[model samples]
Target: APFRMSFAASAKHVRVLENAGLVRRKVHGRSHVIRLNPAPLAAADKWLRYYERFWRERLDTLEALIRAEDKAATRKRSRK
Candidate 1:
């Protein structure tokens, strides 16, 4: 399905995307063609993956610490 928007709103959104290096616009007479530039998106994906891995590792360490503490608490309660 084709997307629909007001010309002014569309132009504003296109300008933002163009500035971000995510889209390119080519004008031919009265017509304009917009194309996706994938390089910027690929770079963004790579950066996100790096941080995702970093957070995953930190969360795993936190889970392990919480489990260990819970086990110690259980043992202490049993002995009391």
Candidate 2:
């Protein structure tokens, strides 16, 4: 069939996905149904979220410094 993968290839991919904890499958009469399990993905997301707050605080400090410099430059220009 055109634009369709063979069942063997699809099954291999499904197995790989299952091993990665990204998917689960059930065999039906002639075809298999696949479902995604987000637990692993969620754990990764949570890990990244923990770092996001830390980076945000650092970026906020940088922004404050930039603004302070901008204000100082404006003050100096006014004195010219």
Candidate 3:
């Protein structure tokens, strides 16, 4: 149901997708069949890699903080 499309709207949507490098269209009879192009995905993947590195650094900092807190708690318990 989600993939259901009318020819006119599909043509417009396909044009936008092609412009964005997200898809390619080939003429098949009266219809232009859409083929997915991977260029946009590659770009997205590159963008996400930067964010992944950022999150990894943040997580490492959090892990160190957690370990320090755990060691402090252990020391306090031992004294009590």
Q: What is the TM-score of each candidate against the true structure?
A: 0.92, 0.65, 0.64
How many clashes in each structure?
0, 0, 0
On lDDT, who's better, 2 or 3? 2
Q: Compared with the true structure, what per-residue lDDT tens digits does model 1 show for residues 35-78?
A: 99999999999999999999999999999999999999999999
> How would you order the candidates by TM-score, starting with the best?
1, 2, 3
lDDT of 3 by residue, 6-61 (tens): 86897798799899989988898987678899978999999999999999999999
Report the Cα lDDT for residue 16, model 3.
94
Model 1's number of clashes is: 0
lDDT by residue (1-80, candidate 2, tens digit) is 76399978977988999999999888899877899999999999999998999899999999999999999999999999
The whole-model C-alpha lDDT of candidate 1 against the native structure comes to: 0.97
At residue 40, give the lDDT of candidate 1.
99
Evaluate model 2: give its lDDT: 0.93
Evaluate model 3: give its TM-score.
0.64
Model 1, runs deviating above 4 Å: 1-4
Considering lDDT, where higher is better, how would the candidates rank from best to worst? 1, 2, 3
